[model samples]
Target: MIIVALDPPQNVDVEKWIKIRYDELKEYVQGFKIGVPAIIRVGLEGLSKIFKDYSGLLIADLKLADIGDVMALTASIVGDYGFNAVIAHAFVGYSQAVDELSKTCEKKGLKLILVVSMSHRGSEEFIDKHLESFVEIAKRVGSWGLVAPATRPLIIKRVRELIGSEVKILSPGIGVQGAEPGTAICYGADYEIVGRAITHSENVKQSALKIIENQKQRVAKCRG
Candidate 1:
């Protein structure tokens, strides 16, 4: 399950790459990740046009961190705009905004993926320490999925253990960030969220295909 993190800086590139990737690499990956950067540059409505017909999973990586009601409204907008799933932060705790956001997504038919840990440096200092709390919150909210950083193998294993078969673990921080392919899922990830490695490659399709192949072999091994 490879999700292309489509994050081109310019609006023109965003649209261009989206069509190309969705057309060429749709079979190679399970879905596509549309982050805030792309949404901001192109505006939700503008981006919506490109994704409106894209029948695959359109995950909005908004990382929504706000009051439950506010976050729910924001997610509702994304859902209205055609996004089926959304990524949000767990740092906000599990009661008000975070909890409400989950319920809102349920009512709207939007899948929620909570961010428990990050791939970048320095994030581990805080997120790593609170891994248990984050996983617990993610479970309590009935998240459809959870975000884990591939760069941290130990943490990913811990996360998988805590959550078990409750939710899908979507991991990022691969390729350019240095976490090797065929590795994260072995540790626990159900899906991989990759960006620059494929989008920035001279041959985007090939890079994506390689990831798809790696994921297949890894999954087979895990099953065996």
Candidate 2:
């Protein structure tokens, strides 16, 4: 599945732009990822309005890393905004914050996707070292999915091996971040979170279609 990360520019009409993107690519991609930039620009209430009729998966990339109480409240807010799922940080540890987020997400009918590892260079400094621990936390909390980086296919492969198939993996860092389309899926990711590539393209629908086709070819080759 290809999940478009809608990080619109602060100067444009965030809601309208999101709606346009959604309408254009909804048929091709499986879902949308709303990151902090868009949320901060339009707020959750605005998101509620924009996605009021959207039936596809809507994920709030909040990356919640606060205390248990705060995380729970945030998850509730995201749910109230009509988000289907939410992303949280797994480095926050297992028993408290992550656990509360998981429970709250479940109560609110939202899938909790934890960020086990990141896609940037700095992530290698710390997050990469604790990859196993993060995976363990996700398993213990019974998280619905995990955020792995597409930039590092080996990391996605290792994460898939550790978690097996019970939990899903969502990978970012495609396109602008340098990972080719389908690179993550070829390794192990169930979904690729693409942002600028499609959003910045002149023809949104075509870019999305091209990406989907590329992913299909890669997956077929890997299986064969």
TM-score (C-alpha, index-matched) for candidate 1: 0.94
At residue 76, give the lDDT of candidate 1: 92
User: What C-alpha lDDT does candidate 1 achieve relative to the native structure?
Assistant: 0.86
Off by over 4 Å in 2: none
Instruction: State the C-alpha lDDT per candidate.
Output: 0.86, 0.91
Candidate with the greatest lDDT versus the true structure: 2
RMSD of each: 1.6, 0.9
Q: Write the per-residue lDDT of candidate 1 for residues 1-224, one digit (tens) a residue.
A: 78889888554666676677677777677899988888887788887887777777889999999999899999999999999999999999988978999999999999999999999888778877898999999989999998988998777899999999868999898899998776788898888888989987878899888878877787788779
Error of 1 at 135 (Å): 0.8
Judged by TM-score, which candidate is best? 2
lDDT at residue 42 of model 1 (Cα atoms) = 73
Q: In candidate 1, where is summed lDDT lowest over 10 consecutive residues?
A: 9-18
Clashes of 1: 1
